[model samples]
Target: MIGMGSSRTQRPHTDRRDWDNLKSVLPFLLDFRSRAIFALSCLVLSKVATVGVPVMLKGIVDALEHKPEQVVVLPIALLLGYGLLRLLSAAFNELRDVVFARVRYRAMRRLSLRVLEHLHTQSLRFHLERKIGAISRDLERGTRSVSSLMNFMTFSIIPIMVEFLLVGIILLKEYPPIFALITFGTIAVYVWFTLRMADWRMDDRHTMNTLDSQANNQAIDSLVNYETVKYFNNEHLELARYDKTLNEWEGYAVKSQTSMSLLNFGQSAIIAVGVTIIMWVAANDVLQGQMSLGSLVMVNAFMLQLFIPLNSLGMIYRSLKYTLADMDTVFRLLDQQPEIQDLPHAPALKVAKGEIRFEQVEFGYQADRQILHGLTLTIPAGKTVAVVGQSGAGKSTLARLLYRFYDVTGGAIFIDGQDIRAVTQESLRRAIGIVPQDTVLFNETLRFNLQYGKPDATQADLEQAARMAHIAEFIAKLPDGWDTVVGERGLKLSGGEKQRVAIARAILKQPPILIFDEATSSLDSTTERAIQRTLEEVAGDHTTLIIAHRLSTIVNADQIVVLDAGRVVEQGTHPALLALKGHYAALWELQQREEQH
Candidate 1:
């Protein structure tokens, strides 16, 4: 049997943990290689044109400083060049964004799809333990973060670095060493301060995220269980729970905002000092005739150009870091390994006879709490076997194991003498149909939920299944008929209605093997008897396993298996087991007494 032991937990994201997560996003970005190349080309050309704008401005200033008669003629060409350079820079930047839009948005789409597919592949145990609201929040943040990180990296961070390099080259080549020293020094200090402050402020952001997720989870949980909340009159309790999280989040949010103001002040101060000193030196040089007025103008223009992006540096850095943290959550989700997987080179399950055998199977949701213990049973080809047991006897687990929702921990399960673990899970599942005890329908039209069983089923086939399941008439009475919307988890429908819908869906599947897990438990006695007859008709010539609570429903089964504490205590024909005066008989007597009253 396949091993049913796999465990993992999500770790908090840190700088050290985020590198791999960032690297994981590279493939998505690289998928559109031509677009990436074109976008990057635009980035380079834009910055080059941007740098030339300040140089053109310097030329305009110098040209106008010439003899008054020649000033008008000389400066016109320079002024036009300046404007052209500015326009080219803006055009190139906009073009870059237009070309890269596909890459950025498609990356988000592909990554979102990847995360969703991965979530589906995860084990039932994983999903059962997860909170839907928190997971959805992470998914939303993570997918958006892909675009955010790329935007900051491509448009904000990279452009700033390119501009800095150009400015540094100009300062070093055309001016004295001190000019380069003060400019570079100020930048280094500014970056260092921003990094340190942002790093400290990360705690605030992380706290806020945690509290936000908690608040969101609580609200969704309460809403999902709205009936329970109302029944208990606990509206204020839910509000208090949500408010507790929001209050904590607000504290961190205030701290974050206030800290941001401080960081901005510090950054501005450093830039101000650097600019003031540069202007002081430039003005002194022009007065001493060591530098022209145009040189001072060029210096001031370069500072303005450089400082604009530099001013946004802190915000960009924090946003990029936040995005990486979000992406780490998504990548960690991807890192989860499914507990159940088909063996190497596993073949499709060929259900020629559809005989199912559970041989000494031992299983549990947890190691310490065994749910099924060495239970052995069988349903022969084209026969029906009904398993009856009290709660916690592992009846539902049989369906889970057979469907490979969780692999058996010990021994093996086989169909047609072929080990289930040795075949592809998709093929194994395709050969079987099940109607679970609890039926959950999508919040969509009744037709959508019914057609889910057989997407390509004909309209006639659909109506036939619904009629057979005894739900067609009920649906026909509705104003919207098949188009009627089923609310969340089919809450709009009565329990019996939902069960009938499930039966119809399973009937439409028409698989060789069928499992009815308390399929008629929700119906009244009259509807139960009617649906039971329909089920019997549908089960003809198909291997069927019925897990039932009511003893009356399965009296006609070919064999009855009595389970107590996950062990098969007895197995025989229904009448034979009733006559045996064993556990099955005792349980039958008790249920009959309850029914009579």
Candidate 2:
């Protein structure tokens, strides 16, 4: 796998960054267009009632000014109209919520699925660099923020803009043009200042999000390695580390609140000046009999409704910044190109006899540090081959390259005379099964984990695979049998038990080519002997690759290949290699001495 690029980086948003992030989600809105339109219509109707409230108040005030006899039923009518308007506003807003819930949920589901699919496409190295907690938090926060923005747009931003337009038109129609001018001008200044302040506070939002992901990663790491912490008596140290992250998050939150306080104060000050000027003019007009008393009341009510949402403009803008910061990470994850994608017209692999070959394969995880150097080897059809090498001799690289987790830098690998790169990755992987040295299980039921290999395997098939892997006896003795729950990463099971579960999974796959990467290294000698017999029986007439830790396990393999410094130093039957007294012979002798000690 190649190194990560800037496409994987989550830099903070700049101009139109929010819109750029949102573009990925535009499909959800379009898919549910009718619902979105209905919700938008509700918003408009609700605002109409909102703006109508002030007009109703003006009518009520005018009716009260009439002599009691002249306005018998008029005041009652005005009061009822005012009550209906308030109810209409509340009702329409609630209806909008109901209408848009589907769209919001669907958008979240689709976005989350895309991120998960993209993450799976990433190479193992990419995953090794990304902490599970941090990446999970990024996805969680991104999806949540995306859902929240819908509410921000419908309830806060769009409604506020609509109210502005309505209030401007009403003021121009009913009063002096200067009143409209002052109201619009004040709103414009409030929005501009709020935006500038929000942009300045974006740093705090980024810091908060970074701190949040760091804290989560620390917690996940500590908990996952709970045994290690206890063994070292580092409980206090772990707590201190977690507390430091919390303290940073607390500091950023405090700064955010303080900045919000200052912004709100400035917004209120601008609005107060605008309100005072407008009311002063209205009061003078009323005293001079140029405007009615109801007119003063109507203008005041308009100012109240307008300022209510305007006051929240700063908060909405701040939330927008936070949303962009959260989603930037998810978008960046999607932007990454898979290091080893199949060709556009790649076909499924056809494994006639599963003859595997590495012809002059050269590769490196990094450009400056090559691992495998011009290595070439072959496993004949229906034959078992053993690969033995010292650590860092590029043994594991062979398995990864065959799995197409990465493409070799030079040369090619072939199966049945067809280049592996010419085939689709999915089909190629499907034809091979591996039992790795480090077996990590999902936190699920034992039955579910076993079935993960072949979901359609019958109960009888599952039992046969388990028996062959030497795990059926242990599972049958359990209180819940196969239904027993395996804790996170199969922590409830011993290392040997987890390895057996992995063996059972691979056995269930029953692929034509099998790679046993120290498959029995974790098992006890008695169990290893029994499972080794079963493995030989299963390997009959199929290609097998074994990376052996205990040399005794591969003594009966059809052929043995010894690797040194990324090259094949020797290849022969066990007895022939023993006679040659080469690297294989020395390794066998060293292991024999260790066992004797």
Candidate 3:
């Protein structure tokens, strides 16, 4: 398991023109382009209808002013026509929302599944080195940002551009140079300020997000180890620590919100000034008979229509900045390459009889420290072999080598005349089954856990494996029997029961090679005695390797190898080693003395 060490301070950096990152998600959208294109077409039509509203108003005003006595019904009908168009536009906008939501949800699902698949192919060491909580949070944040990006692209960017073009065309056609020049100039200024504000705000938001992740991770870490807090009476201390993290998060959050408020307020003031000046100039034109009253009304309405889309653009810009920041974290995780990877053309393993051999194997987790040094061992097919060692003697590391969890730095390990490293890891592992010292079980039913090794196993097969592992009787006594939900991490089951479940899973696998890494350490003496009988019965039909701390557990082994400081010190039958009176003999003597007391 990876330790959550002191939190590292992350510097906030926003990518300029991260609109390119939007391209990374384009393929997903392209896959559903037919739907997306239809949605965008509706969006464009909605904007056209929205723009036509002000034009209709201008027409009604002109018709009523010029021919008030002729007929009032015509102008009234024009007003109702514009109202219907607005209603239709609103309906299309709502429909567009539905389409965008489907795209967002589908993209999120695809990305999350890809991340899961990549994680599955990674080596065990990668998982051991990473914080699971942090990785999960990163992926979640990325998916949400991608969804937001899709929403903005469809609803904000496209509609805003369409609105801008319509307003420009209307201004040029009605009130030539002045209206067009002022509108374009004001838009330029708005874009500049929006971009500047977005740059600063994105930086602040990134900091806030980092702080939030840290605070969340700290709280989860504390909760997961609640027992430690209670035992140490450090609940108050942990609470204070969490409170500090929360305060830091609040500090950044406040800064971000304050900046956003200032930007919005400044932009609103600018828009108010520009709109006031343009209307004032139009009113002067109307007085001089250069422009009609209806045209003035139309110019004012068009400006307001343009501002609506521009305002939406501001919100989209902000969202885009946040989406980019989130994507940065996610991309970094996806880019991480596992230290161990499969070789091209790696052949599948086929072992008829499990004959294992280690030829001068040397290994280490790091360059400076060697855990196994030139270790050599051999176990003939269908033999029961035992490895006895003190803590840190590299006994378990040897078993890991057999499964190619980490390739040996020197020499080789072979099973049935084939080098383990030369075969595909999947094939190599499938031929062997391991029952680790610390059994892990999901929060699932007894039947589900048992079937994990053999998903297609029948009820009869499950029961047979359970009986062999001495867990069927205990499982039957549960309230819901095989349907009983094992609480998180099998916390609902006792240590012995958990181990028996693990054993049953391994038994169901029925691999040709079996490894027990202190398998009975969690069980009571009676439970161990019963499991020992099961082990003996199974050993006759398979090649078994046992790493034992208890000398009595492996006393009947065909051969026992005693290791000290990463090197084998003795190899012989248990009785023969006792007679040799070496390190193994000394260990046996110590066990006898301790048991007598």
Each model's backbone clash number: 0, 0, 0
What tens-digit string does per-residue lDDT give for candidate 2 at 516-596?
999999888999999899889888867999988789999999999998888899999999999999899999999999989
Off by over 4 Å in 1: 1-16
Q: Is candidate 2 or candidate 3 better by lDDT?
A: 2
TM-score, candidate 1, is 0.97
RMSD of 1: 3.7
Clashing pairs in 1: none
Leading candidate by TM-score: 1
- By TM-score, the better pick of 1 and 3 is 1
Which candidate, 2 or 3, has the higher TM-score?
Answer: 2
lDDT of 3 by residue, 1-597 (tens): 223354656766655346566667898898889889889988988988998998898888888888788556888889899899899899889888877677778999998887888787777789877666667787889888888888777877878888888878877886768888888788888889999988867766877887777667767777767778889998897777777768888988898889888988877877877788888899999899998778888888888888767766777788877888888777666677766666889999998899999999999988999999999999989999999988999999988889887899999999999998888888999999988888889999989998998999999999999999999898888889999988777888888888899899999999999998998998898989999999888888889999999988998888999999999999999889989989998998898999899
256-316 in candidate 1: lDDT tens per residue?
Answer: 9999999999999999999999999999999999888888999999999998889999999
lDDT of each: 0.90, 0.88, 0.85
lDDT of 3 at 488: 76
TM-score of each: 0.97, 0.96, 0.95
Q: What is the lDDT of candidate 2?
A: 0.88
Candidate 2 stretches greater than 4 Å from native: 1-16
lDDT of predicted model 3? 0.85
